[model samples]
Target: MSRTDPQFKLRVPAALRLQIEQAAQATRRSMNAEMVVRLEASFAKEQPLQEKAHDQ
Candidate 1:
């Protein structure tokens, strides 16, 4: 939620939203922060697959 970063509005299913809220509460992070961390982790996980694909 920085002024410099592009902002987006997301619409998620109710179940997913509840999961995120619960995770945020457990981790003491805002819902937005929780989502961002999860997104970054997912993208980071993809990089290894992408590197292997390029090596093939």
Candidate 2:
């Protein structure tokens, strides 16, 4: 995200933090970017299920 984007403090467990750090390094992304990408993927995956449930 750009410097102008809104920012917030997040607190995660140390183990989870380490996992994110490793994943970020493997993917060549900042930790924040890795989190954002994973979060968005989760939402995208859930949306299809949500839409199917709404249709039923």
Candidate 3:
């Protein structure tokens, strides 16, 4: 299957931008992929435990 990539335009503080770049390098992932993964994980954490439990 062909996948279409999603793009986001974010305005981050300079310090946070540097941190993201560093994290991307440390994990050997491109900046875009690193940001997407981080955002997904962050949203996943905010999900209700009950909702997640029901999914399983």
Candidate 4:
């Protein structure tokens, strides 16, 4: 997606937000991009586990 595109908003705890911001700065990416990448990876990892549990 384009950087200018409308993005979804996620509300996180203050401490978590600070951690995300710090990581974003370290990675040289904006908070939005960093969060999206993290969340996408998490979901990708989780989906297979969820599917396996459902099949059991």
Candidate 5:
């Protein structure tokens, strides 16, 4: 992460943590990058639905 970006403290189960580590290695990304990418994609997917709900 960039120095200007904020940092957060998070805890994960062992199984999930292992999965994330493996995925990050496979994708050649840091664990933080992997998590941020997944979270951003998840929120982006949900944003459209949220907008639709607001319109209704």
Candidate 6:
């Protein structure tokens, strides 16, 4: 994220935070990037289901 990118404060359970930390370390990314990647992937997963629903 850049200085121009909007920032939002978020709170997650400690367990979840730890999971993110581990994933970030393994992927060699910051916590912020890890969360962004996972969030984006979630949206990608939903896209196909959304299209199926729209078709029906």
**Which is superior by lDDT, 1 or 4?**
1
Candidate 6 per-residue C-alpha lDDT over 1-56 given as tens digits, one digit per residue, 9 for 90 to 100: 78789998999999999999999999999999999999999999999999999999
Worst 10 residues of 4 by lDDT: 1-10
Q: What is the lDDT of candidate 5?
A: 0.95
lDDT of 3: 0.84
Q: What is the lDDT of residue 18 in candidate 2?
A: 100
What TM-score would each prediction reach against the true structure?
0.84, 0.86, 0.69, 0.70, 0.91, 0.85
Instruction: Encode model 5's per-residue lDDT on 1-56: one tens digit a residue.
Output: 69789987889999999999999999999999999999999999999999999999
- For candidate 3, the 10 contiguous residues with the lowest summed lDDT are 1-10
Per-residue alpha-carbon lDDT of candidate 1 for residues 1-56, written as tens digits (9 for 90 to 100): 67689887999999999999999999999998999999999999999999999999
As a TM-score, model 5 comes out at 0.91
Would you list the clashing residue pairs of candidate 5?
none
Error of 3 at 18 (Å): 0.3
lDDT per residue, candidate 2, 1-56, as tens digits?
Answer: 79999999999999999999999999999999999999999999999999999999
- lDDT: which candidate is best? 2
Q: How much lDDT does each candidate structure score?
A: 0.95, 0.98, 0.84, 0.91, 0.95, 0.96
Superior candidate under TM-score, 1 versus 2: 2
* Clashing pairs in model 1, backbone N/Cα/C closer than 3 A: none
> Is 1 or 4 the stronger prediction by TM-score?
1
Candidate 3 per-residue C-alpha lDDT over 1-56 given as tens digits, one digit per residue, 9 for 90 to 100:
11476655889999998999999999998878788889889878878885878899
User: TM-score: which candidate is best?
Assistant: 5
Quote model 1's TM-score.
0.84
Q: How many residue pairs collide in each prediction?
A: 0, 0, 0, 0, 0, 0
The regions of model 1 sitting more than 4 angstroms off are: none
Candidate 2: residue 54 Cα off by (Å): 3.6
Q: Candidates 4 and 5: which is better by TM-score?
A: 5
| RMSD (CA, Å), each prediction | 1.4, 1.2, 4.2, 2.2, 1.0, 1.3
